[model samples]
Target: MLRLIAATLCLRCQRVRALPANLRSCATLSSAENRHTVEALYNLSVDIQKIRKLKGWVLHQSPVYVREVADLLKDMGASGAIVARILALHPEAILCSPDQVRAQRELWMSVCRNQTELVGIIEKFPASFFTSSSHHVNQRDNIAYFQSLHLNKRIITKLMASAPQSFSRPVGQNEVMVCTLQQAYLELGGEEANMRIWLQKLLSQNPFVLLKPPEVLRQNLLFLRDKGFTTAELLRLLSKLRGFVTELNPDSMRHTLAYAQDTMGCSEAELRGIVLECPALLYYSETILAERFQGLLGSGIRMAQIIETPTVLELTTQIVNYRIQRLRAHGYDIRTGSLKPLSGTKKDFEMSYGKLQLRRERPLFNPVAPLKADD
Candidate 1:
């Protein structure tokens, strides 16, 4: 019955918007008696479990209203918990006419394809249903335009998962943005006709890149290009992790670069090398980078070696400190391996240098901050 209401009345109710001053002719509009029944059910005392069932309709459920709204959601696969959560976050959503909610739910289900997917997104963004069906239609058009790009399903899913709000843009605006990006990628060169496909995939993997205005993406590439990254290097960075360009703060990148050259004694060429190896280093706090370099030097690792093995920069201060202290306690020299172990995984570290068997006799590791040794 609820499904029937969702399928038949959703768009029809949306078309009406509101009952006219003379609703006498409209057959589907809930009568005053229906409102009274809803109020009666709402006031009826019930167990906590049943309360969950009534949650979405408690505040505003005429017989017709409950049938169309809450039951529609339940029919679409929203659990009692999900229904409760949506109501608690936006109880006034129940005040919306049943038709609007049916239309909205139908729209969500069309793209999301399942109750779980719909619920997961709602959990993350509880206000998703706040907008009217008109807003939803616009967003739906944006998604349809993306599909029209001939992108693979993997790319589409990834993009939507990363930045669901992209669906909220006006359909016309989204069409323009997609066209702008498509042209940019085509001119990006390489793979000829496949360049646009590559660009779509790149944006999907690095959804944060799409959150920025299209101009920002262009400006970032230009910034890196002017900073001596060749076309190949810029492409590598954009493809691997576009956020390196988009999330980068120019001041932060510069300060880290200066620290690398002046304080750490890395030459210009070496700094560039380090960035290519680990572009994320530019975003690290100056203080931590300095401390890590100091620790390495204090342990007899050469500055030139550190520059050559720039991958070691990915090591956190806590992991390095913990490893170094453990090595010294067990009479092992920290510099014996030239910090090669720094690039190894946690399992490798624990099995080879960590001596986990011995650690068992000691206090437990703190899961909250595993970097800290036992007090």
Candidate 2:
């Protein structure tokens, strides 16, 4: 009977051992189901976030936070039913408040004890899990948060370097105008073309230059009109131009002086002297100067008076000759005179003639009578 009792005890112990094994198998299955369910939910969240991005919603938080939460749920080893129940109890509670996240981290540490692998997993969870702070709402704050992840500093630097400097000061309106004018001036050709371009550019840049637009036009008309440019054309051109001084080229001044001399029927030498003495007048060339000279002369204006008082006689002679030539070329009757004179009687000539006549009369009277008497 004692032997029978011993066999029975052994059988009971064996059954108890089998019960523990069955419980362990059930727990393992539950843990695997919970992991699968959590993974699915996390995947769904990711899909939603992606959709939000496609819809142009700003993702202010780091993606790693979501992933870390999913990983933690996977490591929990809870049953799918239990996980579903937990999620249902507080639908969005997986994302803990900052304070709650910190508490959870502390609890995880206590539960994990000195397990290195568990500690590693806890460390991998996002810092956001420990704080409810919405610092990520700001892009700069978000960048700082990412840097805290021990990412490569070089990568951050490179990203910053690649970004455009949008904060730099914008070009001023005045500066823009100046730049535009400069470009136009460069594009135009010839002296007149250049002047037009320059004037336009200057005016466009600074409207103040044309404070008296009509007056400016009148002045330009008067000046250019005198240089043989048609008054109407001068008016049209000045109306179109903007800046006066900025468009003035030193070389253009020379050409203008030449034109003025030509129009005024003045010699090149005289024009050059005038330009040297009064540089302001050298705005037209010989052609224009000549035309102007004929106009003035036709109006019965005297050349001597028009040429400044300081001009030498030689310069006046040149001016006269140039005027005569131009007038003749244009089919106008022009009379010219030389500096020298033709043969004419003078007081000295008469005195010399009288002396010669007295000498000849005395010789004829005295010599002729003696010769006849001697014969």
Candidate 3:
């Protein structure tokens, strides 16, 4: 009992000594109420280990900076929870001065449309806006750079949200790439106005290409050229599907070709022609290729027509069956199919096939919308 009393006295004396220092340095923490409010701003219960790692930095941050950052975000309609998530990411982000935080927040709000959209972007890629490199006016500059290229705001939003890493690249590197791609495109016989138009469309369509190294583009082109793809053919292929080139390695390419020749029963000549005609073929897996072929062939689309219009290999079974049934109902022959359904754009297909009128004419027929996925 005497030893226990001695240990309790020492613990009390230690707390007494530490209290004076804590009160002297941290006026806010001197009161339990103030301490509770300050912590409520940054402390969240998610990812406990990571949030704990931020504690030391939080201790040294100025109370004014912390208060202002939280107030600024809250005033603009950000909730307490969102503020906590942001601060937990980088406690020093509070040290970024309240004005800097407000400016970044507003800029993101403009790009993402509203606070909820901005929060989604933050959740998707926190480093895009909350990192040290993203502080102050960097977000505005990055945004202005894309706008300078005359890209529409909708396209910019899509690009930023879909692949935030696209904006994570160095400013100069991005500029150099745009210039190089333009010059290379011009060298390939593109006229000046057409080159700008083409680049805009292609960039909007395949913004992910910006994330790749220049070597990747070069390598894709060289590999195709060596495989008997003409420059014209290569460009056409890329326009249809940009991801195909990046997703394939030499081994995968070989396997893809083998499946087309062996499983799909395409001859060597037919395989070469198909790859040249529809580079999307290289992008699809062997499984997808097999399924598409079986689906089309099972719809009574003959082998010769399938070879002639290899793009039919892109459609799913449900779609193939739907179009075939509709064609039969409308007295169109499926045994000798035209390339219009598979090769043409959806608008073209709808216009040429009169899908809308056909559907209205035959109440029992319901053509699935292209964008709608089958269960």
Best candidate (score: lDDT)? 3
Minimal lDDT window, size 10, model 2 = 160-169
Worst 10 residues of 3 by lDDT: 40-49
Of candidates 3 and 1, the better by lDDT: 3
lDDT (Cα, tens digit) per residue for candidate 2, span 1-375: 999999999999887676543233332322223343333444433332232334212122222233444444445543344333333333343455444544455433432434343334433432322334342223233235325533344333222222212101122322343344444334332254455444444444433442322333344434544545443433334334434433444456656765565555788667545544443344345554556556545645456645653222222334545544544443444333221110012343345445545554565355545455554
Per-prediction TM-score:
0.64, 0.18, 0.60
Better of 2 and 3 by TM-score: 3
TM-score of candidate 3 on Cα atoms, chains taken together: 0.60
- List lDDT for all candidates, in order: 0.61, 0.40, 0.64
- Per-residue lDDT of candidate 1, residues 1-375 (tens digit): 899989788878766665442332423423323444333223321122343345534433433343345565677677666665555555445556777776766766556657777667665564565455656666677667767777665565555555656666666755555555555454454455766666676676566555566666576666666678766666666655644356775667777878777865766766777778877777778897888788777767777767767766777767777777776666666565555555556777767665534654466765677484787
Cα RMSD (angstroms) for every candidate in the order listed: 14.2, 39.0, 10.4
Return the lDDT, model 1, position 28.
43
Better candidate by TM-score, 1 or 3:
1
Question: Pick by TM-score: which candidate is best?
Answer: 1
